[model samples]
Every structure is written in C-alpha cells, then in structure tokens.
Target: MPRKSNTDVLALFDTLVYTCQYRLVLEPASHVSARVLEWRQGLRERIGLFHESYHMPSIILCSTELPPEYERSLVDAIARGSEGFASFNMNIGGVQHSEDKRTIYLEVGEKGIIAALRQRVVDHVRTNRRIKKLGVEVVDHARLVIASGLKADQFNAAWAMLAVQSVMVQQKVSDVVLIKRELGDTSMDEHVRTFALTQGV
Candidate 1:
C-alpha cells in the first residue's frame, strides 16, 4: 500500500507509521482502533524505504535567478580543455510534471563535455550540501510530464513542439541550488538556496 499522507498512522518511537488502515501515535495513552492496528507479531516484516525529496531550485532552473559565482570558473575550465567548445548560456528546455503516482520530465539536449559539467555540479551538491544529500543520479533527459490522471498520449502535441527544439544549451550550468517545499509537490520548487557556477561547476 502507498504511504499515507494523512489519516491513520502508527508511532512506535516518534515514528509516524500506518499498519493496515489504522493510524497510530507514540504516547502510551493514545488510543487506536483495531480496524487498523500495528502488527505487533510481524517484527520480521520489512520496514520500509524512505528517500529525501528534491526539487529543482530556481537558480539555474530559472532564468531570472542570479548566476552562481562558480559558474564562471567551470565555464573557463571547460572552454580551455574541451575542444570545439566556446561560450554557452544556461538554458532549461526539458519539461517535467508529476502528480499522484506518476511523474514526467523533459529531455535536455547537447552532449559532449556539458554532461560532464552537469555531473560535477551534482557531485558537489551531493557531497557538500548540509541538510540532506539529494541522491546523485545522472538524468539523461530534460523530461516534462503532462501530469497523471490524463493520458500520457495527451502530451503528443507538447512533445511535438518541444521535440523540434533542443533545450539543453552548450553553456554553463550557472549554479546549483537548494529548493524547499511544504510537505509534498516533489516536482520543482522556487530556489531557496544557491551555489554559484561562476567559480566551479
């Protein structure tokens, strides 16, 4: 069953959990209905998997945000080392959307060293960021999701228009940023924190 966003839950030790359909809490006096109750006998049952939520920050993800200081350094380094490379701009072309159980992302184009640069930024964030490490994974596409409850086929028109234009620019990643949201909305959020690419990718 999907994790509950609200309603019945169980809490053994400050952990809010749900067993069956009932909700639970920690305090000894808290009452629970047998309609849904924690399975005291199944200690061997699998616990669960949890992941840190990530949202694309408004910095490089948005056009108006200030360029990170490290971006200049990364750009200069790439220009010097990568052949056939000149200058590039930070461009976001891929589109992605996720609702309910599904998500969609847009594809980013332009291969070569730009991919490497993107990796560096990802590595830096995964290593240095203070709060929680957003797992590092190379997203090959700048994906856009049309949304759930609607047919994926509905995106045919959008895909056609986007399909014609290459979105990932050969330029700099600009910066890495940390974005925050309330509880959900895992899609993309306005950037609340930022790291510049002017100094490094």
Candidate 2:
C-alpha cells in the first residue's frame, strides 16, 4: 500500500500515542518484488487481512518526535547488497497527518522487496523472545513512520498535501536490524539491539 494514507484520511484509526517498534527496508528490485507491488496496490483493498492487522509497527506501536535516518552501517551495507539484489533509493513521501499521527514516512519504490524485508524483520525480532512479547510484526512493509502528534500537525498537513516527485539514489540491503532509539534534549541516537540478517558477516 502507499504508506501515507491518513489514519484520519479515509482510515479507521483510534486516537492514541503508541510506543516502541521494529522496522526494516527492502530492496525494490528483488526476485519476488513484483508480487509485492501487485499485492499491495492491486489486491490489498480486497484482502481484509491487509488493512486490519497489516499496519506497520512504526505507525501503530511507536511514537517519535524525530524521523529515522538510515544507520551509517545500514547505509553502507545496503549499498554493498545492491550487487546481489535490486535496490532502490529511499524517498521521503511526505509528512502524513491523520487525527493525531503526524508521521513522516519513506516511500517504497520497489514495494516487493520492502515486503520481504518486513517479514524477515519479524522473524528476526522473534528470536529475541522479550521483544517478541512487545508484539511487533513484519507483514506490512514500510520504510518508516515516526509520529509528530498534534504539536506538529500543521507542518505534517502542509507536506502531506504536496506530491512525491524527488528520486533518490538507490542503495543495497546487506542487513536488516532492530535498533533502540534513545531521546536526548535536542537529539536522538540509535543503538543496535538485534539483527534481522547478518551483523558482522
């Protein structure tokens, strides 16, 4: 699905600020990539499972004042993975605001690979057991969706109205991971908590 539909815009979402999440990006041009796009765009509306429980963890489980940027290693690893996979650069769709979720999301160019990546992330997080209890899943693939809440609704609305046109340089995906973001007075830093694929290899 196109990741920016409002939980407020033609979406049925309850009002609440959720916390915590697990996320990963996919290589757009991968082998089964075609299936993902066909499913998300064409078949999703017909599949009740797609909309009912397929919401991204970042969208429904976590709240962030800041949007997530690719980790330095993640960026490099993805570039390296491009040799074996079909990679597409990350694009910022826009700031999307619903009733309360002022989320900034990255648009998936190769929606298929992104979907596969999501499932892989779910499998990886499950090994943690503890985090598994947190109830994060990988079925619904999306790059990222950090909430801004009502405080930044105006900014989100302004951006959401704008169309997505910018093209980004594609990157590879050597690894997928779950990271913990700790907030500071003026900034936040990520600490790698678990790996969905390879960490050192």
Model 1 whole-model lDDT (C-alpha atoms): 0.31
The estimated TM-scores of all candidates read 0.34, 0.39
**Predicted candidate 1 versus true structure: per-residue lDDT over 86-128, tens digit per residue:** 3345344444444432333333344443455544444433343
TM-score of candidate 2 on Cα atoms, chains taken together? 0.39
Count clashing residue pairs per candidate: 37, 4
Residue-wise C-alpha lDDT for candidate 2, range 9-102, written one tens digit per residue: 5233222323332233333333224333333233233322222123322222121121233234333433343223333344333323344444
Alpha-carbon RMSD of each model: 19.4, 16.2
Q: Where is model 1 more than 4 Å wrong at Cα? A: 1-87, 90-107, 124-137, 143-150, 156-173, 185-188, 199-201
Candidate 1 to native Cα RMSD, angstroms? 19.4
Number of backbone clashes in candidate 2: 4
Full-model lDDT for every candidate: 0.31, 0.36
